[model samples]
Target: MHGPVSTAWSLVALCAATGAYCLLRMRSGVEEQRRAAGGEALMGFGMAVMAVPAAVYAPPRWAWPVYAAVFGAAALRALWSARAGAHHLHHAVGAAAMVYMSVAMAAAPTAHHAHGAPGVPPVTGALLVYFMGYVLLSGARLVPAAVPAAGTGSGGARARWGDRPELARACRLSMGIGMVAMLLAM
Candidate 1:
C-alpha cells in the first residue's frame, strides 16, 4: 500500500485494538461500561472496513447494497433506542453516514468509484466534512480533565470526563483524525 493507505490502515488497526481492549475491560465493569465497550468495538470494526484501501478491496457492487441495508438496520435500532441517551443519537448518525457512503459508492461511475478519488460528488465531500467535525468534537468531549483532589468523594476516586474509558476516548480521537485524513485524501 502507498503512504496514505498505509497510514489509514495503521489508524484502523489502532482503533480496532482500542476497541478490543475496551471489550476486555468490560468483563469487570458496570452495565454502562459494558455497553460503551460494545459500542466502541462496533464503531472501530465498522470504521476499519470503511477506511480500508480501495486498491486492496473496494466493495463489490452488490456489497454496497448490503452495506446500506446493514447500516440502515443499525439506524433503525438506534432510533428505537433513542431513550437510552445522546450516544444513541450519535449511533444513529453514524449508521446514516455509513448508509449514505454506501449509496454514494454504488451510484458513482465505475471510473470514479475508487475511494478518495477526485471524481467524488460534492455531497460526499460535504458529508465528509460534516463527519470530520462531528467525530473530532465528540472525541474531544470524551477527554478527561484534571480535577482537584479535594473534589473526590470519600472513595477518593478521580472523576472521569464521561462514562467511556480513557483508551476508548483516545481511540475516538484517533478515529476522528483518521477520518479527517481520509476526507482530505478524497
Candidate 2:
C-alpha cells in the first residue's frame, strides 16, 4: 500500500482504540442511556477496517451494496439516537462521508481511467475528511474539560460523562493525528 493508505489505516486503528477506551470507560447507567457513543466508536473502527481492503485491493463492483448498506445503516442509526447536538451531528456527517467513500471505493476498479483520480482513491480522501471531522468534534467536546478551572460546572459534569477530561482530550488528539496520517497517506 502507498504511504497515504498506510497513514489512513493507522488513523483508523487509533480511532478504534480510542473508541474501545471510551466503551470501557462507560458506566453502567451511561452505557445504557447513551449507547451511541460506543456504537459510533465501533462504527468508526469498522470504517477504518473497511478502508484496509479498499486500500490494498481494487474492490469489486459488487462490494458497493455492502458498503452502502453498512455506512448507511450506521449513519441512520447514529442520527436516530439524537443523543446530543454534537453527537448527532458527528454521526450524521460521518455517515454522509462514508457514503462518499463507499462510492469512491466501488469505483476503484475503473480508477485508472477515471477523471480526477489520485494515487489513492478519492473516497480515501473523503474517509480521511470524515475521520478527521470525527477527531475534531470529539476533541472539541473534550476541550472544555481539558482546560483547568474553566468553571466547576462542566468539569464536574465530565466526571459523570465517562473518562477524565485529560484522557478524553488525548483520545481526540490521537484520533485527529490518525486522521491526519490517513490523509497524508492518500
Candidate 3:
C-alpha cells in the first residue's frame, strides 16, 4: 500500500508475521484448517510484499500485473473450494481484493503514495466496508462460547498452538485489519 515509509514497513512486519503464523497453522490436525491456512499464508506474504515501501525498493512495473495474476488464480481456487464450504467464499473475496489493489497500484504506481490524489475510489470504499465488517465479525467469533463448564473439571487441555481455532480466527482478524489499512492507503 502507498503510504509513509514507517507505515509501509509496519504493514510489512504485520503481514509477514501473519503469514508465518499461517504457515505454522498448516500443521493443524484438522484438514479444513490446514487447507485454509495454506491460502491465508499466501495472502499474508503477498500483502507483505505489496506493502513494501516504494521509496526504499520500488518493484518493476511488471510486478503489479504478476500480483494481479497470482491473486486472480487464488480467487479462482477459493471459489472452487467454496462449493464445498462457505469459509472459502471469504477467501475468494480476499483474493479478489488483492487483485483490485494490484491493478490500482499498476495504474499509478507512484501517484497513489503522493499527497494529491483525488477522492477514494468507489470500489475501494466497498472493499474497506467489507473488510471492516469481517474484522468485527471475526473478533466477535473469537470469544469463547457460553456453554456451562462441565463439572468444573479441567475441561480439556487447550489445543496446541498450531491447532488452535481461536488463533486462526485472530489471524483472520489481523489480516482483515491489514486489508482495511491497505485499502485506506490506496
Candidate 4:
C-alpha cells in the first residue's frame, strides 16, 4: 500500500531543511568540509525531489533517467575521491543506491506502485541492510560520551557555524534515515 500523504510531506520538509543546512555548511573555511557539504546538499535535495509522493506530483517520464544520470555521476566522483579516504567509499555507495532506486523506478514505475510487484529485489535488500547499519552507527555516535574536551585546544568558543561536527553528524543522520524511508517506499 502507498504511504500516507503526511509522511511524504514530512520527508519533503526534513530533506529540504537538511539540504539548506548543508548549503550553509559549504561556507566553511576548510576546503574538505566545503566539498563534502556540497555533495551532501545535492543528495539531500535530490532525495527530497524523489520522495515527493506520486499522488501529489507525478514526475515527467524523463525525470527518473535524469535522476539516474545525476546520481551515477556523483557515484563516479565519490569513487574517484575514495583514494583520499574511506568515507568517500561510503559516499560512492550512497550515490550508487540512489542510482539503483532511480533505475528501478524508471524500469517499472507501475510495478513499484503496485501492491503485487515482485517482492524486494536483492539489490534493494542489500542497500537496505547497508543503510540500516549506517543509521545505527550514526545514531550511536550521537550519544554523549564522557570523553575529555581535547577539542578545546582548537577553536574554542568562537567556532564557525559550519564547523560544528555535531550538527554535521546530525544532518548526515537525518539523510540516512531519509534514505531508508525512500528505499522502503520503493
Candidate 5:
C-alpha cells in the first residue's frame, strides 16, 4: 500500500502543473520575461520529474550534481539580471533557494549515515527545504490581491499581471502540498 509520503508526491506533481499553467498564461513581451516564464515552466516540469525518483529512492550522489548544474545556472541568470533591477523579488529568492538546495544536495554523500545526519537523507532534506522556500516565494505572488484597493475595478492591473489571483493561489497550494510531501519523504 502507498504511504502518506506518496500523497505528498502527488501534491508536488499538482503544483508543477499549476505553476506551468500560470507561467504559460502570463504575457511576456520582453525577451527576458519570456525567458523567465519559459524557465519557470521548465523548473515546474523538472520538479515533477524529480519527484518520481525522490518518491522511490534516495537521490543518488550523481543526481545532486545534475540538479546543481540546472539550478545553479538559473540562479546565476536571475542574479545577473537582477543587477538591472528587472527581475521580481520572488524570482531572485526562488533562484537563491534553488542554488542553496543544489549545493546542499551536491555536498550530501550517498553512503553510510553521519553521526549528526538529519533523520531524512541530507539531499532529500535539502530538496524539501528548497522546495518549501519556492512555495513561499510563489505564494508571495498573490500578496497584491490582499489589498482591497488593488482589487477595486483595476482591470488594467489584473490584466497586467495575467492570470487571476485564484490561479496563483492554486499554484501556491499545489507547491505547498508538494513540499510537504517532499519533506515527509526526507
Candidate 6:
C-alpha cells in the first residue's frame, strides 16, 4: 500500500485494538466504567470502518445507502436518548457525520479514487476540522487533573478522572492525531 493508505490502515488497526480493550474493560466492576467502555468500543469500531482506505474496499453505490441507513438509525437512537448525557450527543453527531460522509462519497465524481489525496473538497475539509477539534477536546478532557491534598474531604477522598480511563484517553489522543494525519494526507 501507498503511504496514506498504509497509515489509514494502521489507524484502523489501532481503533480496532482500542475497541477490544474497551470491551474487556466492561468487566471492571464499575457501572460508569462499563458504560464508558461500551461507548468507546462503539466509537472505535465505527471509526475503523470510516478509516478504511478506498483502495482496499470502497463501498458500492448500493452499499452507500445501506451505510447511511444504518448510521441514520444510530443517530435516531442517540436523539431518542439525548437525555442520557454528553456522550449520547457525541454519538448522535458521529452517526450524522458517518451518514454525511457516506452520502458525499456516493455523490463524489471520483468515488472510486484512492483514499487520500492532496486536495479534499471544502465540505470534507470542514468536516475534518470539526472531527479533529472534537477528538482533541474530548481527549484533553480525559486527562487527569491535579488537585491539592488539602482539597480532599476529611476522609481523604481525592478527586479522580471520573469515568475516563487511561487507556481510553490514550485511544482518543491517538485517534485525534490520526485524524490530523488523514486530513494532511488529503
User: What lDDT score goes with residue 55 in model 2?
Assistant: 45
Weakest 10 consecutive residues of candidate 4 by summed lDDT: 147-156
List per-candidate RMSD values in Å: 4.4, 5.1, 2.9, 2.5, 5.5, 4.9
- Candidate 4, residue 171: the lDDT equals 95
Q: Residue 181 of candidate 1: its Cα lDDT?
A: 58
- Highest lDDT model number: 3
Over 4 Å off, model 4: 110-118, 147-155
Worst 10 residues of 5 by lDDT: 156-165
Native-referenced Cα lDDT, model 6:
0.69
lDDT of 2 by residue, 140-165 (tens): 76656454556567446546445454
Provide the TM-score for each candidate, comma-separated: 0.71, 0.62, 0.89, 0.91, 0.59, 0.68
Cα lDDT of model 6 by residue, 36-112, tens digit:
66766776776677678878887667877887888888888777767877667766776676677667657664755
* Steric clashes per prediction: 0, 5, 0, 0, 0, 1
- Tens digits of per-residue lDDT, candidate 3, 41-62, equal 9999999999998888888999
lDDT of 3: 0.91
**What is the per-residue lDDT of model 1 for residues 52-167, given as tens digits with 9 covering 90 to 100?**
77778877779879878888888887787778787777667767766876776677566355567456568657767777887768676775576546656658774453443565
lDDT per prediction? 0.66, 0.60, 0.91, 0.87, 0.58, 0.69
* Stronger candidate by lDDT (4 vs 5): 4
Better-scoring candidate (TM-score), 3 or 6: 3
User: Judged by lDDT relative to the true structure, which candidate is superior, 1 or 3?
Assistant: 3
- Badly placed stretches (over 4 Å) of model 1 are 1-3, 25-28, 109-126, 139-144, 150-154, 157-164
